[model samples]
Target chain A: MKDRGLPARISCGPEGSNMQYGFVTIYWRDMIRFVRFKTLLISSLLQPALWLAFFGIAMASNFDAMMAGMPVPAGIHSVGYLTFMAAGIIAMTTLFTSLFGGIVILFDKNWGLMREILASPVGRNHIIVGIALSGVTKSFIQALIIMGFGVLIGAAFFAGYAPLQIVIGILGILAFVALFALGFLFLSAAIAISMESPEGLQGVMTLLTMPIFFASNALYPIDSFPEILRVISLYNPMTMLINGIRYFAIGPDFYALGHHYAFTQMDIALSFLGLVVFSVIMFVLAWWRFRKAVVT
Target chain B: MVQPGPAGDDPIILVENLEHTYGNFKAVDGISFAVKRGEIFSFLGPNGAGKSTAINILITLLTIQKGRAVVAGYDVATEPQRVRESIGIVFQDITLDRDMTVWEQLEFHGRLYDMPVKDRRDRIEELLKLVQLEAKRNELTKRLSGGMKRRLEIARGLMTRPTVLFLDEPTIGLDPQTRMRMWEYIKGVNREGTTIFLTTHYMDEADQLSDRISIIDHGKIIISGTSGELKNTLGRDLIHLETDNNEKAITLLEHLPSVREITVRDTLIVLMVNEDGTRVLPGIIDTLRDAGIEISSINLKKPSMDDVFVFYTGKDIRDEGQGPARPHFLRAGGK
Candidate 1:
């Protein structure tokens, strides 16, 4: 018979840890499942690419003529509408992927696998981090795939920046993606835990996210909006994220997407800092909710 | 062979008047018990008898409400992670990730327990072989049959090589052959050193497998002992007799030395005998025959856990589910 005691060579760390191995284990499981679900990859990638192709092209000419008459911000030349919307599409893809992350937890709860995890020696905080990290990773990769589509379609904004700048921009996009994703993931997880069944959460998420999507500057220039919507979009976190990407990826002059165009050094720093704070707060709230939840 | 900690030493699991409530409903009332190291101890009860709730508290899954529970030398509430590290559970509900393969499932569990990479691979292979699922290693869990899923759950529970394994109705719906095989696997595991605490309503399973059993009813442990002890408490044999003259037969049999207590049903007379039922069956028949009573039929039945349950609870465990609690004395009258 084989040795039945604790495996002789097994050791994951110096001692049994609180979260490291468990976090990575949960993360790896999510990644494995993420890779296996080819349909998910295809659909997530497809929708953003279609948005870039259809809406970017269909509306570009009209936007181009309209934009020529407007004052161009300092430090940048005129730009095509396609490039402006490419970043928005990237943000949208990130939102969509991250927003649905809690569906996996819902499935786990429905399938009773959450109890298996709950009963494990892993820390509850680690479970939250593992799941959140996995969701952020998925959202980042999905956003990058859409960005790849933007590159293939020859969005002039991408070609305008140096290769190093583009890579840095992708990293910047990931930060924004992580923030947006974490916020939505937290909201989704909270609703999932409190709601009786998953059937209503999806409808609720769509209703919740659609307002956030349309109320911001994602699909259109915030400057063109009515006074009240302009105020809403001005303060909307999505607008801040898109604005941060606009300036960080292309240049500060590309902040022309919004009514409040010029961003000082502090403006850029504070925007991302706000995202960091929001992400952290969302994480803390989500963890608290998760700990309080009873998985029948 | 790996040996367990000495028998009758410190208990591997201990509970002291543990209580839990779902709002006002007492799911697990104040019940206390201890399981010896390396013993197959079972909590026997019908549906909703608080078996799962108790197991959940012990496994560190559910929060303990009133009293204390210690598993593997750690308080369940205070050191839940330590308790969790020392235990594994096969839940009554199937908790498999249906999208994943059996290998992936075991690997995930091994990783959670922080097993090293090489050791994890080896253990996964061994476990898959043990469960006879090596051939289906790549098959997704959802594609597996119910029996296969249960086997995988058992294998996953062992992936961590836990010291205490909690099996909550492990063989609830398996076929007889599968159940026997499951028992063999469980016995083999226990022999190798793990202390097993299981909960099941199957009397035969408790009778055949457990070193001791606690019969739980309505959140309280009514009685607990070895199978033989429990059966012996209910007396040796229950003799059922059918006769044309029920009143005359009851009058005549009431005075017999072997028969301790006689309870009359609508048409059948049940006698709790003080001796081996078969030993005194012929003598009782002869005495009754001399009394000119025509005996229609007679049967000598050994006391089972079912009888023990009825004897202790004063009601059928199955009947308790249908309505509110009846008066204790009414049930004690044994209708």
Candidate 2:
């Protein structure tokens, strides 16, 4: 054979820090998939808007008529039912989008595509971080769409705020959305990696979404919930996220559905902290699952 | 013949007593071998022969159950990152994402290996040209034909210019012409000084492509040598004789010193001769004639890889009963 000399050596240093940004690669590939499936992309973006249009309008009209004669306490901003549940819609959209985002991992695993990444030099944590970032990005886009649509459809968000406060409110809402999205995406990834089939993952997700979506304050007020459910909602990450969204979107105190809604600064901070702790715990769970994952 | 690299005879991959088990079933049972730095080496085996299991361990996909393995000068168990960085892989099945374009697939691989932007772009261009997929760069992977997908996978495997490229059944499910063309691409890659570790069940693939062949069966290496050396172990020539009385012919030729071994397949008696067939044919004909056995057909030829494989493994590829052979081993402890 001809002397072709040695193969070209890789350019990375011995420390392999150049590969440290490998999560960016994973994120890029995922985004490509996210956009490439035009049907999936458009449907995911449109689903939340549809929920606001049909479900939000339908429920708001009935609930508003029922609460029209309720006495509003002095010095309290009395908003319509649409305004109340709009924040819930944003929370709901973020929840659903982020929870299903990691289904890509299950699909990749089943199709043998994950073997390429699993055998690469990229750390396992990078895979989790990458999926989490992309899931968060998807949630951000969906949340923004729902916010814009909700406002156009007469949900009284940013009703009396200055431009500066509005910007801060939007940022605060996104902060909560990011944390909540990260938490569910990490949980989804953990389950997806451990599952052997997509059907199993779909079943688990269905089982999870039932309690997570309904047991919290997304659809209506959770104050009337039974004692057991009230305790569960108190600690629910979904409730924590909605609390933050409402505190930022609406005023600190408001009246809706004949119920007085008040959020203290300490309450908002604690809600944010709840999401932080949830996402951290989910991240650790995902990291442990990825470390134990063996794909061949 | 591939010449030794500047590293002299230092092996690029070294494994000692490598064993892997799935629960109580042993997939790879105490196999040991080494691959040189700049040669194509093959593990020639049948289905369920622990080929994929061993490749997965070497690629660091599966945890090392026992023994030690070092790939590209890095311990697979301890320094898997270094090992991963130093090698590339083309899996047995088509692992390409159906939705990804050809360009994106290669680009993704380059990024996975942390290749610089400029280098990734330039290499993508070069590999697209090399694999003749430049025209299909923007086409989705699912749109490409089977051969094109395999070629694209090969290009992706070379994205980082890995020191050792591991291919498991690279040309599986391809047409005859495509299989030949795939072999050419593999040889061209090897000629560029990247040591290739290939596992294939195709006898011709191992014979024509690999610099060394190791016949593995039941999770063990039966033999290892160059193609010529392997074929020579079955003797120089093979003679096929169909006599009117096959039992009498076998008795007559069994005592001939030239005949090394004899096996019967239905009515044909196949003789493996140490001496050249041309000289041994006359003595065999006379012996059969003296035994009052009429010869219906007689043929003489040198041993092919098929003969060598069947001789060593004792399993006929054309037989339908080969499927049960593996499960039978699982029941009997694979002794």
Candidate 3:
């Protein structure tokens, strides 16, 4: 029989440490990775900028009826379809930015980078938190940048609660980031490991990305869709997110929960609660699977 | 009669009845081994040998199927979190976030171990110097070469100053120059009194670095001993000669009392012998010549890990890949 009772438990120096600082370490690396990859920055400006310049203008003439059908809330007016489109565009930008960030986690898995983190002394939950925090950070910056572009294009809202709005925006970004990152992190880690192939990556992306982006309130309002399509859109978590962000950004419009000049704090709170629950579930499931992946 | 080492010193690591299976295939069979603290223990096996699986279990990367593993007094399965908290692992593939610079990557790992901010800074700096990549601290890991990236990984593993450092095929793909440097780094880490448990298929590597090595085959520990002791246990030195007529050569060589084991094939005669090979070389050649056998070529090569593997399993380690074996998880849960 061989004895593998390896002696030496790792010493930071001459003294033994009794603390938990892995979260900070993991978070720092994750943030750096997200920035260095440059995925969000390029997509952030390019996609939304294109939508504002081309989609909002070229199709502006045809979208009149589409805008007319949306019930404009009190004290808010859509002089053109582009005005109605801006909120959805902004929300879509956050949705896309947040959702696509999920795939990058899969990319990391394929490259064996995740194994490095898994093998570390870092707690599994901290690893999830670090990645989620980075994802949330990227989603917020991208959403804010898209909002700036919208403002440049004459998109106006009831400019009163800037602090509350910023807080709401952050809360929305966190909600979206937590849900998308956790779900996708679990998915990507699962796929890369089980398949261990990049060939079917695009198929997987389309399978997940298409349904969320199209079926949700990204391109059109949920009310404008057919009966069956409306049901699908209304049920989607992305629907809750896109609608919530829009109401907060422009305040009570056809998109608002009520036909009044007001924003619902309860809606934002609901999305937060929903996403937090999802984030916890997904995070726990992914961590458990990963902890068993390459080590044993 | 065989005598074992005195058990006066408690083992640094002890694995009892370790086994891992994926479906019907047994990647790591019932294997057991112990590593002493401050010792460089190498798990030597070829391509499909359960080396990686074994190391993974030790490091807590792969879950142990049916066994007991204790590292620095921490149980691997029950206290996996604590096992991970204490162990440092340098995986075979690139594990550092390639998007970040060397400093950022190391800093992140230091924090993962929960090292203090001030302590993390000192650890990262010390690690950079230890891996000889302090100058490239600011450079992105994506821009580094294979060797530099490997060194960076080793440095990252040490960021935690783990009690037992696990390395999985650490130098498999590196160039010769890089492999030598990596070997030195491994030696240097071992010298720091950090116990290292590594897996590799390279026999020369096992001979050069390991204070002791365990030979694993098909998930089983066939033999475990130091480099010299294992080779000595073979009882004779193997002299594999490629000649024109293997049959006639073996027939003549079989008479020599010095020859303990002999394997003959088409144009090769592998003779495991003791004493001087040259003392009987003259007779071997004369007997072949008198027997009208054509001597086109004759080359003698020594037995090594490969020979040792074949001697036990009746198959070469190089052939492990071609068969249906493939890569199997050799040990328990991950690092």
Candidate 4:
């Protein structure tokens, strides 16, 4: 509905030399598109908001001892467990949104729109970056909104933490988003070119989302579970992600780190590096896979 | 529709011994051809004739498994990005986001190519008008008719004003009138000197347009030439005489020197003529008359692109596609 006046020329390169053009504008234009698609936009937010409101409140009473062992200055978990759940759940929203957001990539393939994009003169990285940014921005917004909802409900957050926690939370969320974006984006392109039905996209999302969700600590802490479950949870990428959020949200505590190492910048840096390594590997794979997907 | 010039000038596209293999099936067997700049080249084949595969290869949608493909003088394999830059492709499947409007769709693509925003805006408006879709510019694409969606695809394909355009089964499932409307727009684009390359199975569509065509079957280009050139190369004008029994007619025409080939096709003894049709008509009439066969009807059909296809490959083009041929039918009477 806004005035879309004469568009500015987004030169692919300097003038002369039969320069190619138009890639940057499409990327920017897609950001506006992220706002227009209501169903897709809301679906990202709805999942987390639901978990925060209904599940967090309903399940908190059950998580009492789970919180009692938290070993905060408070003697028992009490309401603090629910609070811990709230912060962790909000971060998990980013995981769910960005990972499965690759479903959109598959949708693009099935409809043959990816062909239109790839056929253009635009650089492949430009397209990849644009979609990644949108997916991250969508997840980040939902994460923040969920955070607010959590506080409003008296989520029992263990506060008095330093302001630096914001950096940790944001960096952690962005890193997780980048890693999932790269990983699932590759998978989406792979599934897309081969996909014959809309069901194929759904089937793939179903296959991926569950493993990543239950294997992580968003729903519960790692130590409460059995030995095998604890090992699996510790190794799970989302486990590390939720731990990062947990440490930042609740100051150093025994519940998350199993010791006083809770607020260390070291853990944040390690998690960030791990996610970055995963991101780079996935990115290279996606770049190669997409190049193959487009040409095939 | 005729142009007077040497035919061998720098062809806008060139493919040499191009081949693709998906396991044991050779979808495109070593085939070579070229299209002159500004010529409307059509790849006419039944559904599985690998027409789509070839289009994919040319547009850089599929990789060439063997040999080489060059478009606008850029090697598709070695310099695919450049090849992508030079061509615009409209796939048979509707690829536009149903959630995005016509204007938004074009703008997103403009940014993909990093068009100077100015050029992108001007091009979008020009194309919206070109497709006669300026009125629906802000409307969601989901509301568009089958024909309108196709027109949007053409507009989308041309947003970058690609030097070469690849349309794979553009009109697959529209009503007759809409099909014709699509053809009209396609012709207009071709007239504007866009080197148009498309693939379709509709017999009439192939005959109606296409300055040149390549007939592919099971991944091999069995034949390639202008429609007339390919038709004339069949070396037979069909003579359909009203014969109650085709076997008797085939036997009669088989021994005749002027008759080149005869086949019982479509309940008619289709006779191929080696002699000039004008000269041989009376003699054939006299011969049939003496046989006590009353002439119920007589018709001659210079081979259509369909005939050229049937002559080279022993199958119809429409049998193709796990994809529904529905969209192709939309263009049937559209032209």
lDDT for B131 in candidate 1 is 84
* Candidate 3 structure quality by residue, lDDT tens digits, A1-296: 11112212221211233434454665566666555657655765678778877898666657665555777655553446565566567666655554454444556676746776666655555555555566666656666666677668765543455787767754654455446455555454444444454667657756877787789866565666789988888767666666565665655544332123234677666765665665566665655554444532
- Tens-place lDDT per residue, model 3, B1-335, is 11234568667688999998879989889888888878888888876677788778877777777989898888887666677777788887777666778888887676656677899999888888888898999998889999999988888777777888888888988998999999999999989989999988777788788988888778898888887777666544555566666777678778877777776533456666675666655666777788787777554444465566556655555656553322111111101
The DockQ value obtained for model 4 is 0.40
Per-residue alpha-carbon lDDT of candidate 1 for residues B136-194, written as tens digits (9 for 90 to 100): 99999999988889989988998888889999999988999889989998998899899
How many steric overlaps are in each model, in order?
A: 0, 0, 48, 51
lDDT for each residue of candidate 1 in A73-192, tens digit (9 for 90 to 100): 665555577777877887777777777787778888888478888777665555666777898887877777777877788666555678888888788777877887887777677667
Worst 10 residues of 4 chain B by lDDT: B326-335
What DockQ, on C-alphas, does every prediction get? 0.40, 0.44, 0.39, 0.40
Residues A1-296, candidate 4, lDDT per residue (tens digit)?
Answer: 11011112322332222333333454455556677778877876677778877888777765664555555655422234467677668656766666555555666766636767666655555455556666666666886777667778876444654556656655655555556455555445445544667786778767877877887777765566788878877666676666666655555454432323344677766766666666666666555555555433
lDDT by residue (B1-335, candidate 4, tens digit) is 22333754777888889887778888888878787889888777777677888888887767667888889998877677677767888887888888788898887776665567899999999999989999999999899999999999998888778899888888899889999999999999988889999888877777787887777767777677777777777565666676665566566667779888765445555566866676777888887777766677777666666556655665445444442322111111112
- DockQ ranking, best first: 2, 4, 1, 3
**Candidate 2: tens digits of C-alpha lDDT, residues A1-296:** 11011112222222534666878888999999999889999999999899899999999999989887777899899988888888888888888888888898998888847988887777677788899999999999998998899999999998989999999999999999999999999999999999999989889988998898899988788899999999999899999999999899987899888889899999999999999999999988887787788888
How are the candidates ranked when ordered by TM-score, highest leading? 2, 1, 4, 3
lDDT of 2 at A254: 90
The candidate, 2 or 4, that scores higher on TM-score is 2
Q: Arrange candidates by lDDT, highest first: which order?
A: 2, 1, 4, 3
lDDT of each: 0.78, 0.86, 0.67, 0.68
Q: What TM-score does model 3 achieve against the real structure?
A: 0.82
Question: Which candidate number would show the highest TM-score if scored against the true structure?
Answer: 2
Off by over 4 Å in 3: A1-24, A37-42, A59-80, A159-199, A217-219, A253-296, B1-7, B236-256, B280-306, B319-335
TM-score for every candidate vs. truth? 0.90, 0.93, 0.82, 0.83
